[model samples]
Target: MQREPYRLVHSVSSKFREMNHKIGLFGGIFQYAWNNRKVVKNEDDETIFVLVVKRYTTKHEPWNYIRPYEILRKCEK
Candidate 1:
Protein backbone atom coordinates (compact mmCIF):
# COMPACT_ATOMS: atom_id res chain seq x y z
CA MET A 1 0.00 0.00 0.00
CA GLN A 2 1.05 3.56 -0.60
CA ARG A 3 0.31 6.74 1.34
CA GLU A 4 0.18 10.34 0.20
CA PRO A 5 1.62 13.24 2.14
CA TYR A 6 -0.71 15.66 3.84
CA ARG A 7 -0.54 19.44 4.16
CA LEU A 8 -2.38 22.23 6.01
CA VAL A 9 -3.45 25.50 4.45
CA HIS A 10 -5.61 28.48 5.43
CA SER A 11 -6.82 31.61 3.72
CA VAL A 12 -9.74 34.02 3.96
CA SER A 13 -9.82 35.95 0.69
CA SER A 14 -7.14 35.16 -1.85
CA LYS A 15 -4.76 38.00 -2.72
CA PHE A 16 -3.72 36.61 -6.09
CA ARG A 17 -5.74 37.22 -9.21
CA GLU A 18 -5.15 33.88 -10.94
CA MET A 19 -6.76 32.12 -7.98
CA ASN A 20 -10.52 32.08 -7.97
CA HIS A 21 -12.21 32.86 -4.68
CA LYS A 22 -14.90 30.51 -3.44
CA ILE A 23 -16.53 32.65 -0.82
CA GLY A 24 -17.81 30.95 2.38
CA LEU A 25 -16.06 27.66 1.48
CA PHE A 26 -13.75 27.24 4.45
CA GLY A 27 -14.65 23.98 6.13
CA GLY A 28 -13.42 20.79 4.45
CA ILE A 29 -13.44 18.51 1.34
CA PHE A 30 -13.60 21.55 -0.95
CA GLN A 31 -10.89 23.70 -2.60
CA TYR A 32 -10.25 26.48 -5.12
CA ALA A 33 -7.16 27.37 -7.16
CA TRP A 34 -4.60 29.80 -5.63
CA ASN A 35 -1.22 31.16 -6.69
CA ASN A 36 2.09 32.48 -5.16
CA ARG A 37 0.88 32.37 -1.53
CA LYS A 38 3.81 31.40 0.67
CA VAL A 39 5.93 32.93 3.40
CA VAL A 40 9.08 32.21 1.38
CA LYS A 41 9.31 32.00 -2.37
CA ASN A 42 11.90 30.72 -4.81
CA GLU A 43 12.49 32.15 -8.23
CA ASP A 44 10.81 30.23 -11.09
CA ASP A 45 8.71 28.26 -8.60
CA GLU A 46 5.05 28.99 -9.17
CA THR A 47 3.29 26.08 -7.59
CA ILE A 48 -0.18 25.88 -6.06
CA PHE A 49 -1.56 23.76 -3.26
CA VAL A 50 -4.72 23.04 -1.33
CA LEU A 51 -5.54 25.14 1.74
CA VAL A 52 -7.38 23.90 4.82
CA VAL A 53 -8.50 26.04 7.73
CA LYS A 54 -8.42 24.86 11.31
CA ARG A 55 -10.60 27.76 12.27
CA TYR A 56 -12.19 30.68 10.47
CA THR A 57 -13.74 34.05 11.36
CA THR A 58 -15.16 37.15 9.83
CA LYS A 59 -13.57 40.54 10.64
CA HIS A 60 -16.75 42.48 10.00
CA GLU A 61 -17.02 43.32 13.71
CA PRO A 62 -14.65 45.65 15.57
CA TRP A 63 -12.21 44.32 18.13
CA ASN A 64 -11.20 45.75 21.49
CA TYR A 65 -7.65 46.60 20.30
CA ILE A 66 -6.62 42.93 20.56
CA ARG A 67 -4.26 41.40 18.01
CA PRO A 68 -5.63 38.84 15.54
CA TYR A 69 -3.24 36.03 16.55
CA GLU A 70 -4.32 36.43 20.18
CA ILE A 71 -7.93 36.17 19.15
CA LEU A 72 -7.22 33.07 17.03
CA ARG A 73 -5.37 31.40 19.88
CA LYS A 74 -8.24 32.06 22.26
CA CYS A 75 -10.68 30.62 19.76
CA GLU A 76 -8.60 27.44 19.32
CA LYS A 77 -8.94 26.78 23.06
Candidate 2:
Protein backbone atom coordinates (compact mmCIF):
# COMPACT_ATOMS: atom_id res chain seq x y z
CA MET A 1 0.00 0.00 0.00
CA GLN A 2 1.12 3.54 -0.62
CA ARG A 3 1.70 5.82 2.33
CA GLU A 4 1.09 9.54 2.55
CA PRO A 5 4.09 11.78 2.87
CA TYR A 6 4.84 13.23 6.25
CA ARG A 7 4.39 16.97 6.50
CA LEU A 8 5.10 19.33 9.32
CA VAL A 9 2.43 21.88 10.04
CA HIS A 10 2.98 25.42 11.23
CA SER A 11 3.77 26.33 14.86
CA VAL A 12 6.85 24.14 14.95
CA SER A 13 10.11 25.84 15.78
CA SER A 14 12.05 27.24 12.85
CA LYS A 15 14.90 24.91 13.67
CA PHE A 16 12.73 21.82 13.32
CA ARG A 17 11.00 23.18 10.26
CA GLU A 18 14.31 23.96 8.62
CA MET A 19 15.65 20.52 9.45
CA ASN A 20 12.54 18.83 8.17
CA HIS A 21 12.71 20.80 4.97
CA LYS A 22 16.36 20.02 4.44
CA ILE A 23 16.09 16.35 5.34
CA GLY A 24 13.02 14.24 5.20
CA LEU A 25 11.94 13.46 8.77
CA PHE A 26 15.10 13.73 10.88
CA GLY A 27 15.33 9.93 10.70
CA GLY A 28 16.65 8.56 13.96
CA ILE A 29 15.64 6.69 17.06
CA PHE A 30 15.90 7.54 20.71
CA GLN A 31 18.64 5.60 22.43
CA TYR A 32 18.51 4.96 26.14
CA ALA A 33 21.17 3.84 28.54
CA TRP A 34 21.50 2.82 32.17
CA ASN A 35 22.57 6.35 32.97
CA ASN A 36 19.19 7.70 31.85
CA ARG A 37 20.66 9.65 28.97
CA LYS A 38 19.01 9.78 25.58
CA VAL A 39 20.75 10.61 22.34
CA VAL A 40 18.99 11.97 19.26
CA LYS A 41 20.38 11.88 15.75
CA ASN A 42 19.44 12.35 12.14
CA GLU A 43 19.37 10.12 9.08
CA ASP A 44 22.83 11.22 8.03
CA ASP A 45 24.14 9.87 11.33
CA GLU A 46 24.54 13.25 12.95
CA THR A 47 23.80 14.09 16.53
CA ILE A 48 20.89 16.47 16.98
CA PHE A 49 20.71 16.77 20.71
CA VAL A 50 21.24 14.87 23.96
CA LEU A 51 18.66 14.64 26.70
CA VAL A 52 18.64 13.57 30.30
CA VAL A 53 15.60 11.79 31.69
CA LYS A 54 15.03 12.49 35.33
CA ARG A 55 12.69 10.43 37.42
CA TYR A 56 10.36 12.23 39.78
CA THR A 57 7.74 11.07 42.24
CA THR A 58 5.04 11.87 39.73
CA LYS A 59 6.46 11.57 36.26
CA HIS A 60 9.63 11.29 34.27
CA GLU A 61 10.95 14.62 33.05
CA PRO A 62 13.01 14.74 29.94
CA TRP A 63 15.28 17.70 29.49
CA ASN A 64 16.70 19.02 26.26
CA TYR A 65 14.73 16.54 24.21
CA ILE A 66 11.77 16.89 21.86
CA ARG A 67 10.27 14.01 19.95
CA PRO A 68 10.62 14.58 16.21
CA TYR A 69 7.07 13.53 15.37
CA GLU A 70 5.60 15.49 18.23
CA ILE A 71 7.00 18.63 16.69
CA LEU A 72 5.08 17.90 13.52
CA ARG A 73 1.82 17.07 15.26
CA LYS A 74 2.06 20.05 17.54
CA CYS A 75 0.87 22.35 14.78
CA GLU A 76 -2.48 20.55 14.69
CA LYS A 77 -3.53 22.26 17.84
Candidate 3:
Protein backbone atom coordinates (compact mmCIF):
# COMPACT_ATOMS: atom_id res chain seq x y z
CA MET A 1 0.00 0.00 0.00
CA GLN A 2 1.09 3.55 -0.65
CA ARG A 3 1.04 6.37 1.89
CA GLU A 4 0.19 10.02 1.36
CA PRO A 5 2.63 12.87 1.85
CA TYR A 6 2.34 15.32 4.74
CA ARG A 7 1.38 18.99 4.52
CA LEU A 8 1.35 21.70 7.15
CA VAL A 9 -2.16 22.69 8.18
CA HIS A 10 -1.33 25.20 10.88
CA SER A 11 1.50 26.40 13.08
CA VAL A 12 1.02 27.51 16.66
CA SER A 13 4.26 29.39 16.82
CA SER A 14 5.18 32.58 15.04
CA LYS A 15 8.75 31.35 14.80
CA PHE A 16 7.59 28.22 13.02
CA ARG A 17 5.49 30.27 10.64
CA GLU A 18 8.47 32.45 9.88
CA MET A 19 10.59 29.39 9.21
CA ASN A 20 7.98 28.03 6.84
CA HIS A 21 7.84 31.30 4.95
CA LYS A 22 11.59 31.16 4.52
CA ILE A 23 11.40 27.63 3.22
CA GLY A 24 8.83 28.59 0.53
CA LEU A 25 6.36 26.25 -1.19
CA PHE A 26 8.68 23.89 -3.10
CA GLY A 27 10.48 21.76 -0.47
CA GLY A 28 11.70 21.84 3.10
CA ILE A 29 11.62 19.90 6.34
CA PHE A 30 9.19 20.60 9.18
CA GLN A 31 10.25 18.71 12.26
CA TYR A 32 7.71 17.22 14.66
CA ALA A 33 7.43 14.50 17.25
CA TRP A 34 5.82 11.35 15.89
CA ASN A 35 5.10 10.17 19.43
CA ASN A 36 3.38 13.43 20.39
CA ARG A 37 0.78 13.34 17.64
CA LYS A 38 -3.00 13.53 17.97
CA VAL A 39 -5.14 12.36 15.09
CA VAL A 40 -7.99 14.53 13.83
CA LYS A 41 -10.83 13.13 11.75
CA ASN A 42 -13.62 14.61 9.70
CA GLU A 43 -17.35 14.03 10.16
CA ASP A 44 -17.26 11.49 7.34
CA ASP A 45 -14.94 9.30 9.47
CA GLU A 46 -11.93 9.93 7.30
CA THR A 47 -8.74 11.21 8.84
CA ILE A 48 -8.48 14.87 7.93
CA PHE A 49 -5.21 15.53 9.67
CA VAL A 50 -2.98 15.02 12.66
CA LEU A 51 -2.14 17.43 15.42
CA VAL A 52 1.45 17.22 16.65
CA VAL A 53 3.96 19.14 18.69
CA LYS A 54 7.08 20.63 17.26
CA ARG A 55 10.28 18.71 17.91
CA TYR A 56 13.42 20.66 18.54
CA THR A 57 16.56 20.61 20.65
CA THR A 58 18.36 23.83 21.37
CA LYS A 59 21.75 24.07 23.00
CA HIS A 60 21.13 27.57 24.38
CA GLU A 61 17.42 27.47 25.15
CA PRO A 62 15.64 26.41 28.31
CA TRP A 63 14.54 22.90 29.16
CA ASN A 64 10.80 23.21 28.65
CA TYR A 65 8.84 24.49 25.66
CA ILE A 66 5.99 23.34 23.45
CA ARG A 67 4.62 24.21 20.04
CA PRO A 68 1.63 22.65 18.39
CA TYR A 69 1.12 21.82 14.74
CA GLU A 70 -1.61 20.46 12.48
CA ILE A 71 -0.62 18.41 9.46
CA LEU A 72 -2.38 16.40 6.80
CA ARG A 73 -2.00 14.92 3.37
CA LYS A 74 -2.78 17.21 0.45
CA CYS A 75 -4.65 14.72 -1.67
CA GLU A 76 -4.55 15.05 -5.41
CA LYS A 77 -7.93 14.79 -7.05
Candidate 4:
Protein backbone atom coordinates (compact mmCIF):
# COMPACT_ATOMS: atom_id res chain seq x y z
CA MET A 1 0.00 0.00 0.00
CA GLN A 2 1.00 3.57 -0.57
CA ARG A 3 2.25 5.53 2.41
CA GLU A 4 1.21 8.86 3.76
CA PRO A 5 3.59 11.77 3.92
CA TYR A 6 4.75 13.05 7.29
CA ARG A 7 3.43 16.37 8.49
CA LEU A 8 4.77 19.00 10.87
CA VAL A 9 3.53 22.37 12.01
CA HIS A 10 5.17 25.19 13.91
CA SER A 11 4.99 28.89 14.43
CA VAL A 12 7.85 30.83 12.90
CA SER A 13 8.96 34.42 12.70
CA SER A 14 8.36 36.55 9.63
CA LYS A 15 12.09 37.19 9.34
CA PHE A 16 12.46 33.55 8.30
CA ARG A 17 11.79 34.54 4.70
CA GLU A 18 14.32 37.34 4.73
CA MET A 19 16.94 35.16 6.32
CA ASN A 20 16.35 32.42 3.78
CA HIS A 21 16.86 34.85 0.94
CA LYS A 22 20.02 36.30 2.40
CA ILE A 23 21.43 32.86 3.15
CA GLY A 24 20.12 31.23 -0.04
CA LEU A 25 19.26 28.10 1.87
CA PHE A 26 15.62 27.38 1.06
CA GLY A 27 15.34 30.07 -1.59
CA GLY A 28 16.32 27.82 -4.42
CA ILE A 29 15.51 28.11 -8.08
CA PHE A 30 12.53 26.15 -9.28
CA GLN A 31 13.48 22.83 -10.79
CA TYR A 32 10.17 21.05 -11.14
CA ALA A 33 6.98 20.19 -9.38
CA TRP A 34 6.76 16.83 -7.69
CA ASN A 35 3.09 16.68 -6.75
CA ASN A 36 0.40 18.92 -5.31
CA ARG A 37 2.31 19.55 -2.10
CA LYS A 38 5.89 18.74 -3.11
CA VAL A 39 8.47 20.44 -5.30
CA VAL A 40 12.04 20.07 -6.45
CA LYS A 41 14.46 22.92 -6.80
CA ASN A 42 18.06 23.65 -7.54
CA GLU A 43 20.33 25.48 -5.13
CA ASP A 44 23.79 26.27 -6.43
CA ASP A 45 23.26 23.50 -9.04
CA GLU A 46 22.42 20.99 -6.35
CA THR A 47 19.14 19.15 -6.10
CA ILE A 48 16.88 20.25 -3.27
CA PHE A 49 13.57 18.63 -2.63
CA VAL A 50 10.98 20.23 -0.40
CA LEU A 51 7.50 19.23 0.67
CA VAL A 52 5.38 22.03 2.07
CA VAL A 53 2.15 21.16 3.77
CA LYS A 54 0.52 24.42 4.76
CA ARG A 55 1.17 28.14 5.26
CA TYR A 56 -0.61 30.80 7.28
CA THR A 57 -0.02 34.54 7.53
CA THR A 58 -0.67 36.53 10.69
CA LYS A 59 -0.31 39.97 9.20
CA HIS A 60 -3.59 41.32 10.46
CA GLU A 61 -3.22 39.76 13.87
CA PRO A 62 -1.28 40.93 16.92
CA TRP A 63 1.79 39.00 15.90
CA ASN A 64 4.64 39.17 13.45
CA TYR A 65 4.79 35.48 12.74
CA ILE A 66 3.56 32.80 10.39
CA ARG A 67 2.71 29.16 10.80
CA PRO A 68 4.00 26.81 8.13
CA TYR A 69 4.13 23.05 7.94
CA GLU A 70 6.40 20.68 6.14
CA ILE A 71 6.21 17.02 5.18
CA LEU A 72 9.58 15.59 5.95
CA ARG A 73 9.04 11.99 4.93
CA LYS A 74 6.52 9.23 4.29
CA CYS A 75 5.95 6.06 6.24
CA GLU A 76 4.72 2.68 5.18
CA LYS A 77 1.49 1.31 6.58
In TM-score terms, which candidate is top? 3
**TM, every model:** 0.17, 0.17, 0.18, 0.17
Model 3: per-residue lDDT, tens digit, 24-68? Answer: 221122233323335635322122112211212232223132221
**Model 1: residues with Cα > 4 Å off, grouped in runs:** 1-12, 15-66
Predicted candidate 4 versus true structure: per-residue lDDT over 1-77, tens digit per residue: 48754443332344555544432322221222222323434433222332311111121222221122122122221
CA lDDT scores, all candidates in order: 0.30, 0.37, 0.30, 0.28
lDDT per residue (tens digit) for residues 1-77 in model 2: 49754555554567666656432322222233323444434322123232212322124323333465447535653
The clash count of every prediction, one per candidate, is: 1, 0, 0, 0
* Model 4 stretches with alpha carbons more than 4 Å out: 1-11, 25-77
Q: Alpha carbon lDDT of residue 4, candidate 3?
A: 55
Q: Could you tell me which 10 consecutive residues in candidate 2 have the lowest summed lDDT?
A: 49-58
Q: What is the alpha-carbon RMSD of candidate 2 to the true structure?
A: 13.2
Error of 1 at 14 (Å): 2.0
Query: How displaced is residue 2 in candidate 3, in Å?
Result: 44
| Superposed model 2: Cα runs more than 4 Å off | 1-12, 25-77
Per-residue CA lDDT of model 1 for 1-77, tens digit only, reads 37644432333333321122222233111233333344555522223212322222242222222244234424643
Which regions of candidate 3 deviate over 4 angstroms? Answer: 1-12, 25-77
Model with the higher lDDT, candidate 1 or 4: 1
